[model samples]
Target: MNIIVISSPQQELNEASIIGALFEHGLEVFHLRKPTYSIYDTEALIQAIEPKFRDRVVLHHHYALAEKYNLRGIHFTGHYVKSHSDQLTNWYDKAKQQAMTVSGSKHQLKELETLEVPYNYVFLSPVFDSISKAGYKSNFADLKSIEKYKSATQLIALGGISLDKIDQVKRMGFDGAAVLGTVWEKPAQAIAVFMELKAAWEKKDQIF
Candidate 1:
Protein backbone atom coordinates (compact mmCIF):
# COMPACT_ATOMS: atom_id res chain seq x y z
CA MET A 1 0.00 0.00 0.00
CA ASN A 2 1.39 3.42 -0.90
CA ILE A 3 -0.68 5.91 1.15
CA ILE A 4 -4.06 7.47 1.63
CA VAL A 5 -3.67 11.11 0.56
CA ILE A 6 -6.19 13.79 1.52
CA SER A 7 -6.84 16.43 -1.16
CA SER A 8 -7.14 19.90 0.35
CA PRO A 9 -10.45 21.67 -0.08
CA GLN A 10 -10.49 24.51 -2.59
CA GLN A 11 -13.30 26.34 -0.86
CA GLU A 12 -11.70 26.49 2.57
CA LEU A 13 -7.97 25.78 2.04
CA ASN A 14 -7.69 25.17 5.76
CA GLU A 15 -4.69 22.97 6.55
CA ALA A 16 -4.63 23.59 10.30
CA SER A 17 -7.83 21.68 11.09
CA ILE A 18 -6.77 18.71 8.92
CA ILE A 19 -3.14 18.33 9.98
CA GLY A 20 -3.92 17.21 13.52
CA ALA A 21 -6.65 14.80 12.46
CA LEU A 22 -4.59 13.24 9.69
CA PHE A 23 -1.41 13.01 11.78
CA GLU A 24 -3.28 11.33 14.62
CA HIS A 25 -4.49 8.68 12.15
CA GLY A 26 -0.95 8.07 10.75
CA LEU A 27 -1.41 9.73 7.36
CA GLU A 28 2.01 10.58 6.02
CA VAL A 29 1.37 12.26 2.67
CA PHE A 30 -1.08 15.03 1.79
CA HIS A 31 -1.80 16.77 -1.53
CA LEU A 32 -2.78 20.42 -1.19
CA ARG A 33 -4.70 20.69 -4.53
CA LYS A 34 -6.32 24.05 -4.20
CA PRO A 35 -5.65 25.72 -7.54
CA THR A 36 -7.49 28.86 -6.46
CA TYR A 37 -5.20 29.84 -3.60
CA SER A 38 -2.28 32.11 -4.33
CA ILE A 39 1.18 30.68 -3.71
CA TYR A 40 1.52 32.97 -0.68
CA ASP A 41 -1.54 31.48 1.02
CA THR A 42 -0.29 27.93 0.35
CA GLU A 43 3.11 28.84 1.79
CA ALA A 44 1.65 30.22 4.98
CA LEU A 45 -0.29 26.99 5.48
CA ILE A 46 2.74 24.81 4.72
CA GLN A 47 4.88 26.87 7.06
CA ALA A 48 2.42 26.13 9.82
CA ILE A 49 2.33 22.41 8.96
CA GLU A 50 5.91 21.29 8.00
CA PRO A 51 7.22 21.90 11.53
CA LYS A 52 4.70 19.38 12.83
CA PHE A 53 4.92 16.64 10.19
CA ARG A 54 8.56 17.23 9.25
CA ASP A 55 8.95 15.62 5.79
CA ARG A 56 5.73 13.65 5.69
CA VAL A 57 3.25 15.96 3.94
CA VAL A 58 3.43 17.60 0.48
CA LEU A 59 1.75 20.54 -1.23
CA HIS A 60 0.47 20.44 -4.81
CA HIS A 61 0.84 23.48 -7.13
CA HIS A 62 3.12 25.10 -4.54
CA TYR A 63 6.46 24.40 -6.17
CA ALA A 64 8.06 27.53 -4.65
CA LEU A 65 7.29 26.20 -1.19
CA ALA A 66 8.85 22.78 -1.96
CA GLU A 67 12.44 23.87 -1.34
CA LYS A 68 11.77 26.31 1.51
CA TYR A 69 9.58 23.85 3.43
CA ASN A 70 11.33 20.54 2.67
CA LEU A 71 8.07 18.89 1.67
CA ARG A 72 7.88 15.20 0.83
CA GLY A 73 7.55 15.88 -2.91
CA ILE A 74 5.43 17.61 -5.50
CA HIS A 75 2.15 16.43 -6.99
CA PHE A 76 1.22 17.58 -10.51
CA THR A 77 -2.29 17.79 -11.77
CA GLY A 78 -3.09 16.43 -15.26
CA HIS A 79 -2.86 19.95 -16.61
CA TYR A 80 0.58 20.46 -15.11
CA VAL A 81 1.79 17.08 -16.29
CA LYS A 82 0.67 17.55 -19.88
CA SER A 83 1.61 21.18 -20.33
CA HIS A 84 5.03 20.77 -18.74
CA SER A 85 6.29 17.82 -20.76
CA ASP A 86 9.03 19.82 -22.43
CA GLN A 87 10.03 21.26 -19.07
CA LEU A 88 10.38 17.76 -17.65
CA THR A 89 13.02 16.71 -20.14
CA ASN A 90 15.41 14.31 -18.37
CA TRP A 91 13.19 14.55 -15.30
CA TYR A 92 13.10 10.81 -14.65
CA ASP A 93 16.89 10.61 -14.48
CA LYS A 94 17.07 13.80 -12.49
CA ALA A 95 14.34 12.70 -10.06
CA LYS A 96 16.24 9.49 -9.38
CA GLN A 97 19.36 11.50 -8.71
CA GLN A 98 17.48 13.92 -6.42
CA ALA A 99 15.62 11.11 -4.61
CA MET A 100 12.32 12.85 -5.17
CA THR A 101 8.96 11.38 -6.10
CA VAL A 102 6.47 13.02 -8.48
CA SER A 103 2.79 12.27 -9.09
CA GLY A 104 0.13 13.32 -11.65
CA SER A 105 -3.52 12.76 -12.52
CA LYS A 106 -4.86 10.90 -15.58
CA HIS A 107 -8.43 10.63 -16.85
CA GLN A 108 -7.92 9.29 -20.32
CA LEU A 109 -5.93 6.48 -21.88
CA LYS A 110 -4.16 9.05 -24.01
CA GLU A 111 -3.24 10.98 -20.88
CA LEU A 112 -1.96 7.82 -19.26
CA GLU A 113 0.07 6.96 -22.33
CA THR A 114 1.60 10.42 -22.47
CA LEU A 115 2.42 10.28 -18.75
CA GLU A 116 6.12 9.88 -19.41
CA VAL A 117 6.65 12.86 -17.13
CA PRO A 118 9.21 11.08 -14.93
CA TYR A 119 6.87 11.07 -11.98
CA ASN A 120 7.01 8.40 -9.30
CA TYR A 121 3.26 7.73 -9.41
CA VAL A 122 -0.05 8.48 -11.15
CA PHE A 123 -3.66 8.93 -9.95
CA LEU A 124 -6.54 7.61 -12.12
CA SER A 125 -9.90 8.86 -11.13
CA PRO A 126 -13.65 8.58 -10.46
CA VAL A 127 -13.43 4.82 -10.25
CA PHE A 128 -16.98 5.10 -8.99
CA ASP A 129 -18.35 8.67 -8.66
CA SER A 130 -16.97 12.01 -7.47
CA ILE A 131 -18.54 14.58 -5.17
CA SER A 132 -16.36 17.61 -5.73
CA LYS A 133 -16.38 17.31 -9.50
CA ALA A 134 -19.52 15.87 -10.92
CA GLY A 135 -19.42 13.81 -14.17
CA TYR A 136 -15.80 12.90 -13.42
CA LYS A 137 -16.66 9.19 -13.36
CA SER A 138 -14.80 7.03 -15.84
CA ASN A 139 -15.89 3.71 -17.17
CA PHE A 140 -15.00 1.10 -14.53
CA ALA A 141 -13.81 -1.38 -17.13
CA ASP A 142 -11.71 1.28 -18.80
CA LEU A 143 -10.37 2.32 -15.42
CA LYS A 144 -9.33 -1.30 -14.79
CA SER A 145 -7.48 -1.23 -18.08
CA ILE A 146 -5.15 1.26 -16.45
CA GLU A 147 -3.31 -1.68 -14.87
CA LYS A 148 -1.50 -2.22 -18.14
CA TYR A 149 0.32 1.05 -17.51
CA LYS A 150 1.30 0.11 -13.95
CA SER A 151 4.74 -0.98 -15.07
CA ALA A 152 5.46 2.61 -16.10
CA THR A 153 3.41 4.40 -13.44
CA GLN A 154 2.28 3.46 -9.96
CA LEU A 155 -1.49 3.96 -10.24
CA ILE A 156 -3.32 5.35 -7.21
CA ALA A 157 -7.09 5.10 -7.59
CA LEU A 158 -8.98 8.30 -6.76
CA GLY A 159 -12.59 9.42 -6.63
CA GLY A 160 -15.47 7.60 -5.00
CA ILE A 161 -13.26 5.14 -3.10
CA SER A 162 -15.22 4.38 0.04
CA LEU A 163 -15.42 1.76 2.80
CA ASP A 164 -17.63 -0.50 0.71
CA LYS A 165 -15.47 -0.34 -2.41
CA ILE A 166 -12.09 -0.91 -0.81
CA ASP A 167 -12.09 -4.66 -1.47
CA GLN A 168 -13.04 -4.27 -5.09
CA VAL A 169 -10.44 -1.51 -5.49
CA LYS A 170 -7.76 -3.81 -4.10
CA ARG A 171 -8.86 -6.51 -6.50
CA MET A 172 -8.39 -3.93 -9.25
CA GLY A 173 -4.74 -3.69 -8.17
CA PHE A 174 -4.37 0.05 -7.50
CA ASP A 175 -1.16 1.06 -5.74
CA GLY A 176 -3.13 3.19 -3.24
CA ALA A 177 -6.03 5.59 -2.91
CA ALA A 178 -6.51 9.39 -2.83
CA VAL A 179 -9.63 10.53 -1.07
CA LEU A 180 -11.34 13.95 -0.87
CA GLY A 181 -15.00 14.32 0.12
CA THR A 182 -14.95 11.08 2.10
CA VAL A 183 -12.32 12.49 4.45
CA TRP A 184 -12.78 16.24 4.29
CA GLU A 185 -16.54 16.42 4.81
CA LYS A 186 -16.15 15.06 8.33
CA PRO A 187 -12.61 15.49 9.55
CA ALA A 188 -13.34 13.90 12.94
CA GLN A 189 -14.39 10.63 11.27
CA ALA A 190 -11.16 10.39 9.27
CA ILE A 191 -9.63 7.71 11.48
CA ALA A 192 -12.71 5.53 11.51
CA VAL A 193 -13.05 5.70 7.74
CA PHE A 194 -9.37 4.96 7.29
CA MET A 195 -9.71 1.97 9.60
CA GLU A 196 -12.75 0.63 7.79
CA LEU A 197 -11.09 0.87 4.39
CA LYS A 198 -7.92 -0.68 5.74
CA ALA A 199 -9.89 -3.50 7.30
CA ALA A 200 -11.64 -4.20 4.03
CA TRP A 201 -8.33 -4.41 2.22
CA GLU A 202 -6.87 -6.56 5.00
CA LYS A 203 -9.84 -8.92 5.02
CA LYS A 204 -9.67 -9.27 1.27
CA ASP A 205 -6.07 -10.32 1.66
CA GLN A 206 -7.10 -13.04 4.10
CA ILE A 207 -9.58 -14.61 1.72
CA PHE A 208 -7.09 -14.59 -1.12
Candidate 2:
Protein backbone atom coordinates (compact mmCIF):
# COMPACT_ATOMS: atom_id res chain seq x y z
CA MET A 1 0.00 0.00 0.00
CA ASN A 2 1.20 3.54 -0.74
CA ILE A 3 1.48 5.76 2.34
CA ILE A 4 0.44 9.36 1.63
CA VAL A 5 0.63 12.30 4.03
CA ILE A 6 -1.80 15.19 3.78
CA SER A 7 -0.89 18.62 5.08
CA SER A 8 -2.99 19.73 8.00
CA PRO A 9 -5.83 22.06 6.92
CA GLN A 10 -4.50 24.75 9.20
CA GLN A 11 -0.82 25.53 9.31
CA GLU A 12 1.09 24.01 12.20
CA LEU A 13 4.28 25.17 13.84
CA ASN A 14 7.23 24.31 11.62
CA GLU A 15 4.84 22.96 9.02
CA ALA A 16 7.19 23.35 6.09
CA SER A 17 10.01 21.75 8.05
CA ILE A 18 7.85 18.79 8.95
CA ILE A 19 6.92 18.28 5.30
CA GLY A 20 10.53 18.57 4.19
CA ALA A 21 11.57 15.96 6.75
CA LEU A 22 8.80 13.64 5.60
CA PHE A 23 10.16 13.77 2.05
CA GLU A 24 13.67 13.02 3.24
CA HIS A 25 12.31 10.07 5.21
CA GLY A 26 10.80 8.42 2.08
CA LEU A 27 7.40 10.05 1.89
CA GLU A 28 6.53 9.58 -1.80
CA VAL A 29 3.42 11.72 -2.03
CA PHE A 30 2.46 14.76 0.01
CA HIS A 31 -1.02 16.22 -0.50
CA LEU A 32 -1.11 19.99 0.09
CA ARG A 33 -4.77 20.58 0.96
CA LYS A 34 -5.15 23.91 2.65
CA PRO A 35 -8.76 24.92 1.98
CA THR A 36 -8.46 28.47 3.28
CA TYR A 37 -5.20 29.47 1.66
CA SER A 38 -5.24 32.10 -1.04
CA ILE A 39 -3.45 31.34 -4.30
CA TYR A 40 -0.48 33.45 -3.22
CA ASP A 41 -0.31 31.71 0.17
CA THR A 42 -0.45 28.34 -1.53
CA GLU A 43 2.26 29.35 -3.96
CA ALA A 44 4.48 30.51 -1.09
CA LEU A 45 3.98 27.24 0.77
CA ILE A 46 4.92 25.16 -2.27
CA GLN A 47 7.94 27.35 -2.85
CA ALA A 48 9.11 26.67 0.72
CA ILE A 49 9.38 22.93 0.09
CA GLU A 50 12.75 21.83 -1.24
CA PRO A 51 12.81 21.99 -5.04
CA LYS A 52 13.97 18.41 -5.49
CA PHE A 53 10.96 17.06 -3.59
CA ARG A 54 8.41 19.46 -5.04
CA ASP A 55 7.51 16.97 -7.79
CA ARG A 56 6.15 14.61 -5.17
CA VAL A 57 3.69 17.17 -3.86
CA VAL A 58 0.02 17.18 -4.92
CA LEU A 59 -2.23 20.18 -4.59
CA HIS A 60 -5.87 20.18 -3.46
CA HIS A 61 -6.54 23.68 -4.69
CA HIS A 62 -4.73 26.36 -6.66
CA TYR A 63 -4.21 23.77 -9.36
CA ALA A 64 -2.58 26.41 -11.52
CA LEU A 65 0.42 25.90 -9.30
CA ALA A 66 0.80 22.32 -10.54
CA GLU A 67 2.47 23.37 -13.76
CA LYS A 68 4.36 26.25 -12.15
CA TYR A 69 5.84 24.07 -9.41
CA ASN A 70 6.00 20.83 -11.43
CA LEU A 71 3.80 19.12 -8.86
CA ARG A 72 2.85 15.47 -9.14
CA GLY A 73 -0.90 16.07 -9.62
CA ILE A 74 -4.14 17.71 -8.51
CA HIS A 75 -6.85 16.35 -6.22
CA PHE A 76 -10.48 17.35 -6.56
CA THR A 77 -12.62 17.48 -3.48
CA GLY A 78 -16.24 16.24 -3.40
CA HIS A 79 -17.53 19.82 -3.40
CA TYR A 80 -15.38 20.73 -6.39
CA VAL A 81 -16.67 17.73 -8.31
CA LYS A 82 -20.28 18.59 -7.61
CA SER A 83 -20.04 22.33 -8.17
CA HIS A 84 -18.00 22.04 -11.34
CA SER A 85 -19.79 19.10 -12.85
CA ASP A 86 -20.22 20.88 -16.14
CA GLN A 87 -16.60 21.91 -16.45
CA LEU A 88 -14.95 18.63 -15.40
CA THR A 89 -14.55 17.19 -18.88
CA ASN A 90 -12.68 20.23 -20.15
CA TRP A 91 -10.68 20.41 -16.94
CA TYR A 92 -9.70 16.77 -17.15
CA ASP A 93 -8.54 17.18 -20.73
CA LYS A 94 -6.42 20.18 -19.84
CA ALA A 95 -4.89 18.45 -16.84
CA LYS A 96 -4.04 15.46 -19.01
CA GLN A 97 -2.47 17.65 -21.64
CA GLN A 98 -0.20 19.07 -18.97
CA ALA A 99 0.91 15.52 -18.06
CA MET A 100 -0.57 15.90 -14.61
CA THR A 101 -2.04 13.01 -12.65
CA VAL A 102 -5.66 13.47 -11.55
CA SER A 103 -7.37 12.19 -8.41
CA GLY A 104 -10.51 12.95 -6.43
CA SER A 105 -12.38 12.25 -3.22
CA LYS A 106 -15.69 10.44 -2.86
CA HIS A 107 -17.56 10.04 0.40
CA GLN A 108 -19.79 7.27 -0.93
CA LEU A 109 -19.33 4.20 -3.09
CA LYS A 110 -22.24 5.39 -5.20
CA GLU A 111 -20.20 8.38 -6.26
CA LEU A 112 -17.70 6.09 -7.93
CA GLU A 113 -20.35 4.77 -10.32
CA THR A 114 -20.89 8.22 -11.78
CA LEU A 115 -17.29 9.34 -12.24
CA GLU A 116 -17.00 10.47 -15.89
CA VAL A 117 -13.25 10.68 -16.16
CA PRO A 118 -10.71 8.08 -15.19
CA TYR A 119 -8.54 9.28 -12.33
CA ASN A 120 -5.22 7.93 -11.22
CA TYR A 121 -6.92 7.20 -7.91
CA VAL A 122 -9.82 8.34 -5.74
CA PHE A 123 -10.03 8.65 -1.96
CA LEU A 124 -12.90 6.89 -0.21
CA SER A 125 -12.99 8.22 3.29
CA PRO A 126 -14.06 7.28 6.81
CA VAL A 127 -13.07 3.69 6.02
CA PHE A 128 -12.47 3.54 9.72
CA ASP A 129 -13.45 6.05 12.38
CA SER A 130 -12.00 9.49 11.68
CA ILE A 131 -8.95 10.35 13.72
CA SER A 132 -9.27 14.10 13.21
CA LYS A 133 -13.00 14.66 13.20
CA ALA A 134 -14.80 14.01 16.45
CA GLY A 135 -17.73 11.60 16.12
CA TYR A 136 -17.16 11.01 12.40
CA LYS A 137 -17.38 7.23 12.47
CA SER A 138 -16.69 4.72 9.71
CA ASN A 139 -19.63 3.68 7.60
CA PHE A 140 -17.85 0.81 5.94
CA ALA A 141 -19.40 -2.50 6.82
CA ASP A 142 -19.11 -4.56 3.63
CA LEU A 143 -15.64 -4.94 2.27
CA LYS A 144 -16.83 -7.19 -0.53
CA SER A 145 -18.90 -4.42 -2.00
CA ILE A 146 -15.86 -2.17 -2.04
CA GLU A 147 -13.89 -4.80 -3.95
CA LYS A 148 -16.45 -4.79 -6.69
CA TYR A 149 -15.72 -1.16 -7.47
CA LYS A 150 -12.00 -1.78 -7.91
CA SER A 151 -12.62 -2.32 -11.63
CA ALA A 152 -13.80 1.26 -11.98
CA THR A 153 -10.73 2.95 -10.51
CA GLN A 154 -8.12 2.75 -7.80
CA LEU A 155 -9.69 3.34 -4.40
CA ILE A 156 -7.64 4.74 -1.55
CA ALA A 157 -8.68 4.28 2.06
CA LEU A 158 -8.77 7.51 4.04
CA GLY A 159 -9.94 8.63 7.48
CA GLY A 160 -8.72 7.18 10.75
CA ILE A 161 -5.86 5.29 9.08
CA SER A 162 -3.04 4.35 11.43
CA LEU A 163 -0.17 1.88 11.68
CA ASP A 164 -2.31 -0.84 13.20
CA LYS A 165 -4.90 -0.66 10.42
CA ILE A 166 -2.58 -0.79 7.42
CA ASP A 167 -3.06 -4.53 6.99
CA GLN A 168 -6.80 -4.15 7.13
CA VAL A 169 -6.66 -1.60 4.35
CA LYS A 170 -4.63 -3.88 2.10
CA ARG A 171 -6.85 -6.86 2.82
CA MET A 172 -9.87 -4.83 1.79
CA GLY A 173 -8.21 -4.14 -1.59
CA PHE A 174 -7.55 -0.44 -1.27
CA ASP A 175 -4.82 0.79 -3.62
CA GLY A 176 -3.39 3.08 -0.92
CA ALA A 177 -4.03 4.81 2.40
CA ALA A 178 -3.90 8.49 3.31
CA VAL A 179 -2.71 9.67 6.71
CA LEU A 180 -3.76 12.85 8.46
CA GLY A 181 -4.52 13.04 12.19
CA THR A 182 -2.09 10.29 13.15
CA VAL A 183 0.83 12.29 11.76
CA TRP A 184 -0.31 15.77 12.73
CA GLU A 185 -1.28 14.88 16.30
CA LYS A 186 2.39 14.90 17.23
CA PRO A 187 4.22 16.84 14.57
CA ALA A 188 7.57 16.30 16.23
CA GLN A 189 7.09 12.53 16.11
CA ALA A 190 5.32 12.46 12.75
CA ILE A 191 8.29 11.09 10.88
CA ALA A 192 8.65 8.24 13.37
CA VAL A 193 5.00 7.35 13.04
CA PHE A 194 5.27 7.36 9.24
CA MET A 195 8.36 5.14 9.36
CA GLU A 196 6.56 2.65 11.51
CA LEU A 197 3.59 2.61 9.18
CA LYS A 198 5.86 2.23 6.15
CA ALA A 199 7.67 -0.66 7.80
CA ALA A 200 4.40 -2.41 8.61
CA TRP A 201 3.13 -1.93 5.07
CA GLU A 202 6.27 -3.44 3.64
CA LYS A 203 5.99 -6.41 5.99
CA LYS A 204 2.42 -6.99 4.87
CA ASP A 205 3.44 -6.82 1.23
CA GLN A 206 6.13 -9.40 1.85
CA ILE A 207 3.64 -11.71 3.55
CA PHE A 208 1.17 -11.51 0.69
Candidate 3:
Protein backbone atom coordinates (compact mmCIF):
# COMPACT_ATOMS: atom_id res chain seq x y z
CA MET A 1 0.00 0.00 0.00
CA ASN A 2 1.25 3.50 -0.82
CA ILE A 3 1.65 5.92 2.04
CA ILE A 4 1.06 9.43 0.70
CA VAL A 5 2.09 12.06 3.26
CA ILE A 6 0.22 15.37 3.35
CA SER A 7 2.20 18.42 4.44
CA SER A 8 1.09 20.41 7.44
CA PRO A 9 -0.92 23.44 6.31
CA GLN A 10 1.47 25.72 8.19
CA GLN A 11 5.21 25.73 8.40
CA GLU A 12 7.10 23.64 10.88
CA LEU A 13 10.56 24.13 12.36
CA ASN A 14 13.34 22.77 10.11
CA GLU A 15 10.65 21.99 7.59
CA ALA A 16 12.77 21.68 4.47
CA SER A 17 15.46 19.60 6.11
CA ILE A 18 12.83 17.34 7.60
CA ILE A 19 11.22 16.94 4.21
CA GLY A 20 14.55 16.01 2.72
CA ALA A 21 15.00 13.58 5.56
CA LEU A 22 11.65 12.02 4.75
CA PHE A 23 12.73 11.43 1.17
CA GLU A 24 15.97 9.90 2.39
CA HIS A 25 14.02 7.65 4.70
CA GLY A 26 12.10 6.24 1.67
CA LEU A 27 8.96 8.35 1.61
CA GLU A 28 7.67 7.96 -1.95
CA VAL A 29 5.12 10.76 -2.17
CA PHE A 30 4.75 14.05 -0.27
CA HIS A 31 1.79 16.39 -0.76
CA LEU A 32 2.62 20.08 -0.30
CA ARG A 33 -0.60 21.77 0.80
CA LYS A 34 -0.50 25.34 2.05
CA PRO A 35 -3.79 27.04 1.37
CA THR A 36 -2.84 30.58 2.44
CA TYR A 37 0.63 30.73 0.88
CA SER A 38 1.35 32.85 -2.15
CA ILE A 39 2.81 31.27 -5.29
CA TYR A 40 6.17 32.85 -4.55
CA ASP A 41 6.17 31.44 -1.02
CA THR A 42 5.26 28.05 -2.39
CA GLU A 43 7.99 28.32 -5.02
CA ALA A 44 10.57 29.09 -2.37
CA LEU A 45 9.44 26.09 -0.35
CA ILE A 46 9.88 23.86 -3.38
CA GLN A 47 13.30 25.37 -4.08
CA ALA A 48 14.25 24.69 -0.48
CA ILE A 49 13.82 20.99 -1.10
CA GLU A 50 16.71 19.12 -2.71
CA PRO A 51 16.55 19.29 -6.50
CA LYS A 52 16.49 15.53 -7.03
CA PHE A 53 13.70 14.88 -4.54
CA ARG A 54 11.43 17.56 -5.98
CA ASP A 55 9.92 15.12 -8.47
CA ARG A 56 8.35 13.16 -5.63
CA VAL A 57 6.43 16.20 -4.37
CA VAL A 58 2.81 17.05 -5.23
CA LEU A 59 1.22 20.47 -5.01
CA HIS A 60 -2.26 21.08 -3.62
CA HIS A 61 -2.19 24.76 -4.54
CA HIS A 62 -0.33 26.81 -7.13
CA TYR A 63 -0.35 23.68 -9.27
CA ALA A 64 1.61 25.31 -12.05
CA LEU A 65 4.52 25.05 -9.70
CA ALA A 66 4.48 21.31 -10.32
CA GLU A 67 5.49 21.96 -13.91
CA LYS A 68 7.92 24.68 -12.93
CA TYR A 69 9.72 22.44 -10.48
CA ASN A 70 9.15 19.20 -12.41
CA LEU A 71 7.36 17.92 -9.34
CA ARG A 72 5.41 14.69 -9.34
CA GLY A 73 1.83 15.95 -9.68
CA ILE A 74 -1.01 18.31 -8.68
CA HIS A 75 -3.93 17.62 -6.38
CA PHE A 76 -7.52 18.86 -6.53
CA THR A 77 -9.33 19.41 -3.28
CA GLY A 78 -13.04 18.56 -3.21
CA HIS A 79 -13.87 22.24 -2.70
CA TYR A 80 -11.68 23.38 -5.58
CA VAL A 81 -13.30 20.95 -8.01
CA LYS A 82 -16.78 22.02 -6.94
CA SER A 83 -15.89 25.67 -7.43
CA HIS A 84 -14.06 25.11 -10.71
CA SER A 85 -15.85 22.21 -12.34
CA ASP A 86 -15.58 23.76 -15.78
CA GLN A 87 -11.83 24.19 -15.54
CA LEU A 88 -11.24 20.76 -14.00
CA THR A 89 -11.24 18.96 -17.34
CA ASN A 90 -8.81 21.42 -18.89
CA TRP A 91 -6.49 21.06 -15.91
CA TYR A 92 -6.54 17.27 -16.21
CA ASP A 93 -5.64 17.49 -19.88
CA LYS A 94 -2.83 19.90 -19.08
CA ALA A 95 -1.54 17.65 -16.33
CA LYS A 96 -1.58 14.66 -18.68
CA GLN A 97 0.32 16.60 -21.32
CA GLN A 98 3.01 17.30 -18.76
CA ALA A 99 3.20 13.59 -17.89
CA MET A 100 2.39 14.34 -14.26
CA THR A 101 0.21 12.31 -11.94
CA VAL A 102 -3.25 13.66 -11.11
CA SER A 103 -5.24 13.06 -7.93
CA GLY A 104 -8.54 14.38 -6.58
CA SER A 105 -10.34 14.57 -3.26
CA LYS A 106 -13.94 13.54 -2.61
CA HIS A 107 -15.97 13.64 0.59
CA GLN A 108 -18.98 11.75 -0.70
CA LEU A 109 -19.30 8.55 -2.71
CA LYS A 110 -21.90 10.11 -4.99
CA GLU A 111 -19.23 12.49 -6.24
CA LEU A 112 -17.30 9.53 -7.65
CA GLU A 113 -20.11 8.73 -10.11
CA THR A 114 -19.83 12.19 -11.61
CA LEU A 115 -16.07 12.09 -12.26
CA GLU A 116 -15.15 13.04 -15.80
CA VAL A 117 -11.47 12.45 -15.39
CA PRO A 118 -9.95 9.30 -13.99
CA TYR A 119 -7.52 10.49 -11.39
CA ASN A 120 -4.43 8.38 -10.69
CA TYR A 121 -5.79 8.20 -7.16
CA VAL A 122 -8.76 9.82 -5.44
CA PHE A 123 -8.84 10.58 -1.74
CA LEU A 124 -11.99 9.43 0.08
CA SER A 125 -11.61 11.43 3.18
CA PRO A 126 -12.71 11.35 6.83
CA VAL A 127 -12.70 7.58 6.51
CA PHE A 128 -12.36 7.23 10.26
CA ASP A 129 -12.78 10.75 11.49
CA SER A 130 -9.89 13.20 11.30
CA ILE A 131 -7.05 13.10 13.75
CA SER A 132 -5.83 16.46 12.49
CA LYS A 133 -9.18 18.24 12.60
CA ALA A 134 -11.39 17.75 15.61
CA GLY A 135 -15.01 16.79 14.88
CA TYR A 136 -14.30 15.75 11.30
CA LYS A 137 -15.81 12.29 11.39
CA SER A 138 -15.88 9.44 8.92
CA ASN A 139 -18.77 9.79 6.51
CA PHE A 140 -19.22 6.09 5.71
CA ALA A 141 -20.89 3.57 7.97
CA ASP A 142 -19.55 0.58 6.03
CA LEU A 143 -16.23 1.27 4.34
CA LYS A 144 -16.40 -2.12 2.62
CA SER A 145 -19.08 -0.70 0.37
CA ILE A 146 -16.31 1.26 -1.34
CA GLU A 147 -14.88 -1.89 -2.94
CA LYS A 148 -17.15 -1.42 -5.93
CA TYR A 149 -15.52 1.91 -6.70
CA LYS A 150 -12.03 0.45 -6.96
CA SER A 151 -12.48 -0.27 -10.68
CA ALA A 152 -13.04 3.44 -11.27
CA THR A 153 -9.94 4.89 -9.62
CA GLN A 154 -7.43 4.00 -6.97
CA LEU A 155 -9.07 5.02 -3.70
CA ILE A 156 -6.94 6.48 -0.94
CA ALA A 157 -8.32 6.71 2.56
CA LEU A 158 -7.54 10.10 4.09
CA GLY A 159 -8.15 11.39 7.62
CA GLY A 160 -7.32 9.57 10.86
CA ILE A 161 -4.80 7.18 9.28
CA SER A 162 -2.67 6.76 12.39
CA LEU A 163 -0.19 3.96 13.17
CA ASP A 164 -2.86 1.76 14.70
CA LYS A 165 -5.49 2.26 11.99
CA ILE A 166 -3.50 0.71 9.11
CA ASP A 167 -5.14 -2.67 9.70
CA GLN A 168 -8.60 -1.22 9.59
CA VAL A 169 -7.82 0.80 6.50
CA LYS A 170 -6.64 -2.35 4.68
CA ARG A 171 -9.71 -4.31 5.67
CA MET A 172 -11.89 -1.57 4.18
CA GLY A 173 -10.48 -2.32 0.69
CA PHE A 174 -8.69 1.02 0.24
CA ASP A 175 -5.82 1.07 -2.26
CA GLY A 176 -3.66 3.21 0.04
CA ALA A 177 -3.82 5.97 2.63
CA ALA A 178 -3.11 9.69 2.86
CA VAL A 179 -1.80 10.70 6.25
CA LEU A 180 -1.77 14.12 7.93
CA GLY A 181 -2.18 14.14 11.71
CA THR A 182 -0.10 11.04 12.36
CA VAL A 183 3.03 13.00 11.53
CA TRP A 184 2.18 16.69 11.88
CA GLU A 185 0.61 16.34 15.32
CA LYS A 186 4.12 15.63 16.54
CA PRO A 187 6.50 17.30 14.14
CA ALA A 188 9.65 16.44 15.99
CA GLN A 189 9.01 12.75 15.46
CA ALA A 190 7.60 12.94 11.96
CA ILE A 191 10.20 10.68 10.42
CA ALA A 192 9.84 8.07 13.16
CA VAL A 193 6.09 8.07 12.94
CA PHE A 194 6.20 7.77 9.16
CA MET A 195 8.55 4.83 9.41
CA GLU A 196 6.22 3.05 11.77
CA LEU A 197 3.24 3.61 9.50
CA LYS A 198 5.21 2.50 6.45
CA ALA A 199 6.33 -0.64 8.22
CA ALA A 200 2.84 -1.40 9.39
CA TRP A 201 1.48 -0.95 5.86
CA GLU A 202 4.17 -3.13 4.35
CA LYS A 203 3.70 -5.90 6.87
CA LYS A 204 -0.08 -5.96 6.69
CA ASP A 205 0.15 -9.02 4.41
CA GLN A 206 2.02 -10.91 7.13
CA ILE A 207 0.00 -9.66 10.11
CA PHE A 208 -3.43 -10.02 8.57
What is candidate 1's lDDT per residue for 89-205, written digit by digit as tens? 554454445555777777755666665665677777767788566677654654544556676568888888777777677778887887787766666666677666655656646
Query: What clash pairs does model 1 have?
Result: none
TM-score result, candidate 2:
0.94
Instruction: Please provide TM-scores, in order, for all candidate models, with all chains considered together.
Output: 0.84, 0.94, 0.95
The reply for model 3, stretches above 4 Å from the true place, is none
C-alpha RMSD for every candidate: 2.8, 1.8, 1.5
Ranking by TM-score: 3, 2, 1
Question: RMSD (Cα, Å) of candidate 1?
Answer: 2.8
116-144, model 2: which lDDT tens digit per residue?
68998999988989998899988785554
**Clashing pairs for predicted structure model 3, backbone only:** none
TM-score for predicted model 1 compared with the true structure: 0.84
TM-score, structure 3 vs. true? 0.95
lDDT (CA) per prediction: 0.67, 0.87, 0.88
Ranked by lDDT, the better of candidates 1 and 3 is 3
Please report how far candidate 3 places residue 191 from its true position, in Å. Answer: 0.3
Better of 1 and 3 by TM-score: 3
